[model samples]
Target: LHSYTKYNTWDTILSWINSIASSNPSLVSKQVIGNTFEGRPMTLLKLGKSSGTTKPSIFLDCGIHAREWISPAFCQWFVKEALETYGSDSQMTSLLDQMDVYVLPVINIDGYEYSHTTNRMWRKTRSKLSGSSCLGADPNRNFDAGWCTVGASSNPCSETFCGSTPESEIEVKHVADFIRKNKSSIKAYLTIHSYSQLLLFPYSYSYNLAADHSELMSVAQGASAALTSLYGTRYTSGPGASTIYLAAGGSDDWAYDLGVKYSYTFELRDTGYHGFLLPESQIKPTCEETMLAVKYIAAHVVFSQ
Candidate 1:
């Protein structure tokens, strides 16, 4: 129950979610928090046991950047697998029984659609700014963690533009609001990205180490090891600034600021040989392998709690 090739379109992704909700009425519920810049619905899928509010919760999202198709694909695949195996698989069933998973696939719907139609390498939203010709803002850089201070640009045309203000992008604002509403229950926050084999934790805004740096590194190491066990793929685990380039105002840092104990940014699939132009053929294996890491992290979070 994995989809790697299709669902790149907003309609297709929404249709898939709707179909799942229809098929599994008791297990699946969709929440429309708001709309994207292009009027695309910002949807969140709530999965796991239907029991009341005592269970822990996890937040997972992908497609903050439009050109990163692999990000959203893995998210859809994760949701599909979670629902399909919840009853039969002991691990999944146990986790679901004690925890709720909230997944937002295709966060930047307008930019994602725009990438398919006009630009193959588009990386921002499509919001129009007054007195500026730039089309969009980098949703990843629109978060409130050291926003636009470093590793981010002030110019609207830059790829890493932090937007006029924190949470300026509608997509980011919606996600921030959702996370804020569930802050107390959310134990871990994960946002999927692409073009690098990395499992990065905060503080992306600076080279300084996090207060729980040891725990963060430990979880990232475990997740990376799990991913490697599945397909022999190697993933470097560390802080975002050390492992990759420093990028202020990223979702992972913002999640950490919100007191989520475990916050991670996963950069999936092949390295920069293809960059954002990852082939459709690599989708299935990528999603499959990443699932091992995700499940490992989820289990660790549950046990630690």
Candidate 2:
């Protein structure tokens, strides 16, 4: 049986990715985009059946904040669902037939491990910058979108520390660079986080409207509706700054600013009942509903493109 029933550590997650790719040779392949600050290989598992041609793609990642363990678990669950349901489910089959999904299972590998081992709430990269005793920059706040401005903090010790520079975090840099390189074919970007139950789109850095503001709002609405259809779980979807608090430098904003028109950040599950320590028992339901929303977005990207 698939082992996503429980929360997994870094090694277990990596091993699962490897196992999935190896077992699904016809449909899945692996890419090592870069190494983390702690020398862990950051892996991207690309899922699609080969058709002897390049296809439009979607970029998805989770655990950029490290402590949001459920975020990364959703990535794993997504891959598992894609692999297992591809041949049987018409929607997944068609989505995979038309596009490739690039998944980075865990962006903040070092801090994710640290969260499990040392601090259960560590939410930054395990990097040591000059002139600071504090270890780790909030990788989510280290992106180049709005940078350190607004809800992000300049203090290194703050939980929301924006790194010294945009792209300062190696993991963020690698992910950003890869998306930039693949910008032409990347149709959508989805970054998963937790405890807010919101599906947010671009212009997160500012209250100003994105070019496709109305369309993104419409898609998010449909996607949110789809999520609610399963388990009746309610999720509010809108532009990040207005729906959620203004947290600049989020990956969703960075990806949106980079021209991925369908960019979104999924704040998965709970209104803070479990907080960062969401129980493992909730993983399956969370992933189930999240899969619905993801497919809803992926469908929009596929058919609407």
Candidate 3:
């Protein structure tokens, strides 16, 4: 029952994770993939049954946009729920028996902390660029897929600023490297964001449909329907560019490019009344509903194979 509104600080989040890992070493494994430009450690937690060699893996990431506190909270909640219900709940136990869940609670630690300490709306990594005073690069737009093309900004100060080069930000590089290393086992890649209520799939760089468009749309619709069943939260599902605003170089698209079959970007919770300021009370229900969607997708991934 972690509160996102109060625990938005990076230090507190990291400390909480440390405490969990310390107490439950057998269930939680922490891995530091890399360091942010501001020297904050970019950590990931791996959760699953202990005695499996080749379980299918799903990658879940949150807070890539910095101000999306609810996004990261959901990631943390997913980890806890998975660990708590592993052998007791039939669905969770079955999922864990077949798949390993990798959760990156906060992808943009520097920007997330900056949002807590200085600004309430920061959306990028706090990386200083030469010849400009504006800090940070949009980690979402820093991926290598269709780099600097449509739905991205070149100017350093823009909210959608693509970095000077693809994978320029250490955060983006680290995630890319981790995905690459686990490419064989990963079946789904989910990046959680806030304020839009969208379940978006690939080919975000253009209007052209993905080769697996029909199958992707089917899973997206199923996941969306599952969420709606829980809280009547309706989500528009389609290609990222068509469903929402198009943004080039997004992790979802990049993961698709890297051969992860089911890549999605989930824009969670309320649709802009609260916007980035999603309340703590909604965290539990949000995570619970989103978990239904996640399980729907995971079950599909398993059954299809």
For each candidate in the order shown, give its overall lDDT on alpha carbons. Answer: 0.89, 0.91, 0.88
Best by TM-score: 2
Q: Against the correct fold, how does model 1 do in TM-score?
A: 0.97
Q: Can you rank all candidates by TM-score, best first?
A: 2, 1, 3
Backbone clashes in candidate 2 total 0
User: Model 1 over residues 1-305: C-alpha lDDT tens digits?
Assistant: 32446546777888888888788777778999899988889889988788966578899999999999999999899988998899898888888888889999989999999988999899999999998998799999999999999899999999998999999999999999989988989999999999789999998899999999999999899999999998898999999998887889999999998999799999997888887888888888899899999999999988887
TM per model? 0.97, 0.98, 0.96
Predictions ranked by lDDT, top down?
2, 1, 3
**Per-residue lDDT over 20-111 for candidate 2, one digit per residue giving the tens place of the 0 to 100 score:** 89999999999999999989999999999888988999998999887898999899999999988998999999999999999998999999
**Model 2: ten consecutive residues of lowest lDDT:** 1-10
C-alpha-based local distance difference test score of model 1: 0.89
Which segments of candidate 1 are over 4 A away from where they belong? 1-4
Which sections of candidate 3 miss by over 4 Å? 1-6
User: What is the TM-score of candidate 3?
Assistant: 0.96
> Residue 60 CA error for candidate 1 (Å)?
0.3
Q: Model 2: how far is 127 from its true place, Å?
A: 0.3
Reference-based lDDT, residue 265, model 3:
91
